[model samples]
Target: MTMRSTMLLLAPAVLGVAAPALAQTAPTILPDATVLEVSAEGRTTRVPDVATIRAGVVTQGQTAAAALSENATRMTRVLAALKQAGVAQRDIRTASVALSPQYRYAENQPPAVTGYQASNSVSIRFRDVAKSGAILDALVAQGANQIDGPSLSLDQPDAALDEARANAVKIARARAELYAKAAGLSVARIVTISENGANDGSNPQPPIYAMARAMKASESTPIAAGETQVSVSVSVRFLLK
Candidate 1:
């Protein structure tokens, strides 16, 4: 090849390799500006609107078949009472069903099978917090011997969490502005924003376990639906000039 033609071909190849390096060198942020990172948290509270409870029947008999049969009879009545109380079928779910042999222990002898115990339980969700207590009482009267929990939670938490997130950003920006002012500068712009921890607070509290008994006509179970807190934390980086 001629010397001029060789030089021309080499120039294009050199330009191709240099183009990507020039693109990569472009600055993402102002090189002369000071970078400040700040973190802040925000929280909001709302009253719980949903409650979860478990109701079950426990029976003991000489044989497993008898124990299960007796448990089924009582459980059927419990389910019926729940339905009559306006509980939706979708809100009711079988939690557990167990059949185990009872054992007797002697000082010098091995354990002996004494009887059989059978249990059946269902988890129930109450959309109306105020009316759940009355419904719970009816469940006990309908033969629910083992009753557990009224775990309180919010039915919807997305709106509350969004509110908290906005508050977090506001707080983070305020903090960055304060720092910039102390350093004799002003905040130019936000360089980066990242969420640290976002909590919806929909998780239920520890449940209350109780053995329910028949109550008088004027008495009913008491359930308190307290406030739940939704919180968010954010880390923000600001460029100061």
Candidate 2:
């Protein structure tokens, strides 16, 4: 083939590939869209449905075996009393069991082992909050010396969390719409949605300093279980046109 013929044939192939590249490099022209991002929280409160109680027995004796034996006997009564008070077997859990030696120290002498002390504790969960205080009295009658807690919680926390999540989305959408309207723009659609998290926001109550030894006050052990609050937050982005 002649030089002119070769040039003519190559020109078409080069132009065919260049055409696709030119189309790819072309800029797109579309309506300018704005975005509105917002974060919001939802909270709900309801009466607590469950209460947890920690109770135990502490015994002392000259020997470790004697101390442990006495503590075990008392702890048996405590467990029985819990059952008698209507606490289910599934709700009762052993927390701890330990035996430690008591020491007596002199000003310039090494410490001497005086005796041994044994402690046994168990945790109980009461579904019926109304009977908690009365049950506590029952445990005291059964020889429980160390008692702590009436820590309150909700039986079905998932229910509260679900409600909060729904409310969070609704509130976030309302906030985004308000901002868009104030800016003289209209919300086209929701572009994205993300859940931050849910938190109970309640601190655990510390054990009472002196209640460990006493079971009942002069009157019926009075207990007040307040409401349980659940909080949820969410983030949303809305396309504004």
Candidate 3:
């Protein structure tokens, strides 16, 4: 084939590939479109449905074996009381078990071993927050000496987060339209959407501090499941014309 024929044959193939490349690189936004990016946050509050608490027994004795034995006995009773109170076995998880020596410090002398302290703790989840206080009293009655926390939260947060996300988008669009109107322009369309983050803004209650002998026998500990806030932030790009 002549050189001129070879050149003609390759020209169409080169043009075909170049055409698509140009199309891919072409600007998506119209020349008259003005880009406006707005960030907005939306929040909603709901009552917490779950409560988590830590309950434990602490005992001291002259020997590690004695201390551990006493702690085990008390913890057994505590677990039984939780069962009697209708707490599910899956909700009762052992948090910790430890035995440590108690030391007596002396001036200019080696620290003397005084006694051994044994502790056993379990984390309990209460589906019914209203009954948690009464159950706590029962646990104490069964020899749970150390109690901490009734941290409240939502069991399922996906629906609440979705609601917040919708609100954020609404706010962003409203704000963008306001900006457009202020500039004597009308909103053309949304260019893009990006989510910044989501957070659970729960107003946590103060941890409950209870001892076996602190409260009166007739009064059950009171629990209040305060409302928790769910928030979502979004960035939206709108075109104005």
TM-scores, in order shown?
0.82, 0.78, 0.81
Clashes of 3: 0
lDDT winner: 3
Higher-scoring candidate on lDDT, 2 or 3: 3
Global CA lDDT computed for model 1:
0.76
Q: Give the TM-score of candidate 1.
A: 0.82
Candidate with best TM-score:
1
Model 3 is weakest, by summed lDDT over 10 consecutive residues, at 1-10
The candidates, ranked best first by TM-score, are: 1, 3, 2
Cα displacement (angstroms), candidate 2, residue 72, comes to 0.4
Mark the regions of model 3 whose C-alpha exceeds 4 Å error after superposition: 1-33, 201-203, 214-216
The per-prediction CA RMSD against the true structure, in angstroms, equals 14.2, 16.8, 14.1
lDDT of 3 at 102: 100
- Off-target runs (Cα >4 Å) in candidate 1 are 1-27, 30-33
lDDT of each: 0.76, 0.70, 0.78
* Candidate 1 per-residue lDDT over residues 1-241, each given as its tens digit: 0000000000101111111121133226534446777767778888988888888889999999999999999899999999999999999999999999999999999999999999999999999988998998887888888878877777788998888877877877777777778878888876556666776767566666667654866967778887878888766666677
- Per-residue lDDT for 113 in model 2? 100
How do the residues 1-241 of candidate 3 rate in per-residue lDDT, one tens digit apiece?
0000000010111111111121133226655456777778877788888899999999999999999999999999999999999999999999999999999998999999999999999999999999999999899889999989987888888888888878877877778777788878877777666677787644455766667785566878898887888888776667677
